[model samples]
Target chain A: MKATPARDQETVDKWEVQLRKGCLELAILAALWEGKLYGLEILRQLESDSDLIVSEGTVYPLLSRLKVLGLVKSEWVESEAGHPRKYYALTPAGKKRALEMAGIWTRFSSSMGKLLAPLGKGNK
Target chain B: MTMADDVQQRDAQQSMEAYLGRLRRRLRGMNDEDAREIVEELRSHIRDKAAASGQVTASGVDAALAALGSPEELASQYLTDDLLARAEVSRSPVRILESLFRWASLSVAGFLVLLGSMVGYFLGVVFILVAALKSFHPRTAGVWVLPNGADDFNISVRLGFGSAPLEGREVLGWWIMPIGLAAGCALVMLTTRFAIWCVRQYRKSRALPRG
Candidate 1:
């Protein structure tokens, strides 16, 4: 039996959900580690660098939660566009945590890659 | 406007306003201009989508929202990972403690209320009977009052197995016992109702789609 378009879309959506759930934190941290950025700038950076599709909704809540935890501090900066942008910077603790997360992510991805290696070889 | 036109216009307007309201709330503590700009950008995107679709439907609103995701998650991406970690840690401990306290307190209070009501009902019935016998017989009054009163008497009764008093009067004044019983019933009813409301609110909040 052929998979319907809706069923295929549902499968893709589930995969996207899992992917987003797993890596969203790491992606956000990596984006902010470089320099202070506003929400839009961060969104743009994530899309450009990792091809990770994130919604504005996901980013905002995570930021608030982070701020409450005292990991990141935000400041309103006057912009040329006449809007004061909220720029987020990593605290000292944030930087240390980011490094740790990066290490963990590297180990996890490499392990997963190795596990999938057999499948790719078998297909070939 | 025609009925269809009116409905479509209203829907588009409502959707735009709702998104803007959410965006504004999400961007609280940030600069207002930044928040407004974000809202405008989202509004324009939603309008464009609505125009392309030609008719406003629930699906259109959902699609527009899907494009935006939830405001909370959008803000989260701008936060540092350490912040997320801290939030996860800070929130869990406090919430767990709070829920634990709430459940424990409610359970104890409920048990006390139930026990108090049962005791109150027995006392109420006995009081009415004693008051009846005292007024009617007058002769066997001492007999009925003394022995029956001993059982109904809420003096501190120590059980052999327990360290605490098994039976005791809550109020010092015997006259106030009825009032205390009424108050206990009221307290239990109010607490049960509040607990139910809280459960409903929890369920409702959970039912909401998260980002």
Candidate 2:
């Protein structure tokens, strides 16, 4: 007996989910690297810049966790159109973490790219 | 504004409130102020998301809520994250275990830490109990290194009945009380410190899906 393609795809999806979970902290930290942004703005930055589409509810808990770790800080500012919005900014520690994460990601992905280079050619 | 848009706005408001209501219910046992603040922040996020889409239609609200995912899961993540953060600093055994048990539900590292914690605390408790029983049942409730063979031995610590189960001499007759008490308290204190250190490490390493 052999596994189906769907099963293989399921395994890949599981890996994808875990990978995303691992990168979420780094991603949020990176999103706040430029300056303060409200929750929705952060989500939009993640989507537009990185093409990573995270579910909306996931970001809040993650932000809370970052604040607990002293990596990020937040404050509420009045919005002209609606309710006051909570804006998140990277703390000094968060900026340091973001730089460290970026370096790691760059190194990891570059090697990953080298490993994956052959598969892209389809020469075999 | 058209009457149709008015109706859609009202429906959107209802759906958002209903979602928040379920979230508030899930957060009931949490600190009221913290829970209220969470609800407030989420309310603002949802409204901000909906309004930013250029229309406050029911579908816009639906999209916002959908992006946010289920309120139940969201609330649980918030609770677990808060618990683990508090557990890192809290010195109380009950509070630490409460946090660890919840963490255990989510990760293997947490379960292992919790198992270590339980075993450490259990031994500490056993030592204290043996110390107390030394006064009541001096014949049985004490620690000893009973000789098992000519070259080997067994270290035994127990709370028993009748006569002592050992042929070898007891470790510390009446002095066992104060020694046991001190040793038990020390064990407990050391376990607490070790558990806190383990939790801090776990928090540092395990940074994914606080749910």
TM-score for the A-chain in each candidate structure: 0.85, 0.92
Give the C-alpha miss distance for residue A70 in model 2, angstroms: 0.7
* lDDT of candidate 1 over B161-207, digit per residue (tens): 22323334223233333443455455445444443344333322221
**TM-score, candidate 2, first chain:** 0.92
Per-residue lDDT tens digits of candidate 2, residues A34-124? 8999888887888888746776767787788788778899888998876788888998988999999999999999999999998999976
**Which lDDT tens digits does candidate 1 get at residues A103-123?**
998999899999999999999
Q: List the residue pairs that clash in candidate 2.
A: A56-B67, A57-B68
**Per-prediction DockQ, in order?**
0.19, 0.24
Top-scoring candidate (DockQ): 2
Please provide TM-scores, in order, for all candidate models, with all chains considered together.
0.45, 0.71
Q: How many angstroms is residue B87 displaced in model 1 relative to the true structure, after the best TM-score fit?
A: 7.4
Evaluate all candidate structures by whole-model CA lDDT and list the values in order: 0.54, 0.79
Restricted to chain B, the TM-score per model reads 0.34, 0.65
